[model samples]
Target: MLIDIKGVLNLWGSFVRFTDCKGYPTMQAFMRESPQEREKQRYLPRLDDDTLAKVDRQIRKLDPAGKAKAYLANLAKPNDKREELESLESDELQFAILYLRYVAGLENKPIWQKLSLSKGAFENELRLAERFVEGVLIGSEIRLFL
Candidate 1:
């Protein structure tokens, strides 16, 4: 087929702009990532078993009982913020605190300090609390925002 440079190419035929039917960017001109997003990706923390379960025994004990039944029973008055925290078990409450801290834009070290937990303990409880919360949410048929 004879190629027509007139319509297919722009800017002195230097680039085709897009590679395919998808209108994905092929332009050298790129969009700038928002500061919030760039910062999010950079500091995204990774968790490993050693960090979460420092004790071998705790690793085994850290099983989350996935009982979706009797869900929101954990907090009878879900709207009552203080009561909700009071209703949660220590581990769950700790995780909740960490989440609240994150929302407040606190970094890892400071957030851990606010919870009065060392790094390993914080990560460990966070995992367990996560599981418990999952069960409760599933039982209540409430979806997590994530």
Candidate 2:
């Protein structure tokens, strides 16, 4: 079966939201801000103590990591694709997942710098990793043909 690229990208976005490590609201907030604004906000750090406590309480209630793992397991199903994802080289998988996760507002320069990847190389690797993830989702038969 042929997979729709736009559908996959949309699914990938939703998957990233589902697996959000930083809490969904926080991720959404970050997504809403521009990169420069995010950087400024990071430096300025504007949450009040009560708000911070409330956020902490919400985080404790949410258990995002457990929820994300459960969701990923369900998505992977019989294929054990989550295991395959985990088995990828640390940089490759981390970059791919993070790239997808922060698709809304993340800047590539910082990530490439952190990963010690040249711009062109990082882009190439990220593309390949995304393709791999798409294959994993579509299944072994499709992946083998690819």
Candidate 3:
């Protein structure tokens, strides 16, 4: 009277497999974490000598707050809020900064508007802006991606 649970599930177009009924429902969940969760999580890759040095110069000239402000400002969109934060998540902020640095250009409106960050958050982001930017640049280089 044993059933081929895997075969039955497959026939029903539900392909999850588990040892028993007790493990059934949870097997199909998408909440499983990505593979990189256990390892040291690196957001960006290594930069070439020229790019690395250029980035150093850029970072050196900017105070933490200023860099954060600038990086965020570069990401703000047209007609974006002057004092509102963007919807970008914590992890996405690093990528957004790269877009700001290598992709988006400056315009007539203030940089904060484009970055869509409130003053307080922008200031807070500055404290770690350099690290975020470095991670993105380095990771992007390592992956041969932008």
Candidate 4:
């Protein structure tokens, strides 16, 4: 089957959100919402074991800091690349790491709250982060399992 890159990324985003929010009462209530309401939310796809293993390996090859720096560099045009790189916090990697962690069923509340992002904003960030990682992998000629 041809892979739906955007759909897979979106599903990963939802998986992150679900893992992050699952422990909270709010999330529980949301889950308990009517089937129609639940259906409105995005659902994660179930990949085969081999595909999942390959995806996980590809994901592990990512350098979070490098990815974050590249992402920031793209956003700032005609800027001092060295200065920008020097100023980057290791935490900047959290943008991608948090999403990956969420997919792994891990949650980091501090990072999630620190951004103070609305659901839509957070999802957008996750999408960008995923794109960055994908670009890095492809640029390096690494095959994406997804």
Pick by TM-score: which candidate is best?
Answer: 2
List model 4 lDDT by residue over 26-103, tens digit each: 456546543322223313344433333444445545443366536544544654543433333434554444444445
lDDT of 1 by residue, 13-33 (tens): 111111112444544667743
- How far residue 96's Cα lies from its native spot in candidate 4, in Å, is 4.6
User: Can you tell me which runs of candidate 3 are displaced by over 4 Å?
Assistant: 1-86, 107-109, 133-146
Worst 10 residues of 1 by lDDT: 11-20
Minimum summed lDDT over a 10-residue window in model 2 is located at 36-45
Please report, in order, the local distance difference test score of every candidate based on alpha carbons.
0.35, 0.42, 0.39, 0.47
Query: Tens digits of per-residue lDDT for model 3 on 1-146?
Result: 22332222122121111111233244557775333222222222332333334444443333333444444564454545455544655444533443343334333133345556665665455435545544544544422222
Each prediction's TM-score against the native?
Answer: 0.32, 0.37, 0.29, 0.34
Order of models, best TM-score first = 2, 4, 1, 3
Ordering by lDDT: 4, 2, 3, 1
Residue-by-residue lDDT tens digits, candidate 2, 1-146: 55553344443344345445453243465466433211211111233333223332332222334443343344447644434333335433443434433443347776566445688876776666556554544542322111
When summed lDDT is taken over every stretch of 10 residues in candidate 3, the lowest stretch is 12-21
Q: Which regions of candidate 2 deviate over 4 angstroms?
A: 18-104, 140-146
Clashes of each: 0, 0, 8, 0
In angstroms, how far off is 8's CA in candidate 1?
A: 44
lDDT of 4: 0.47
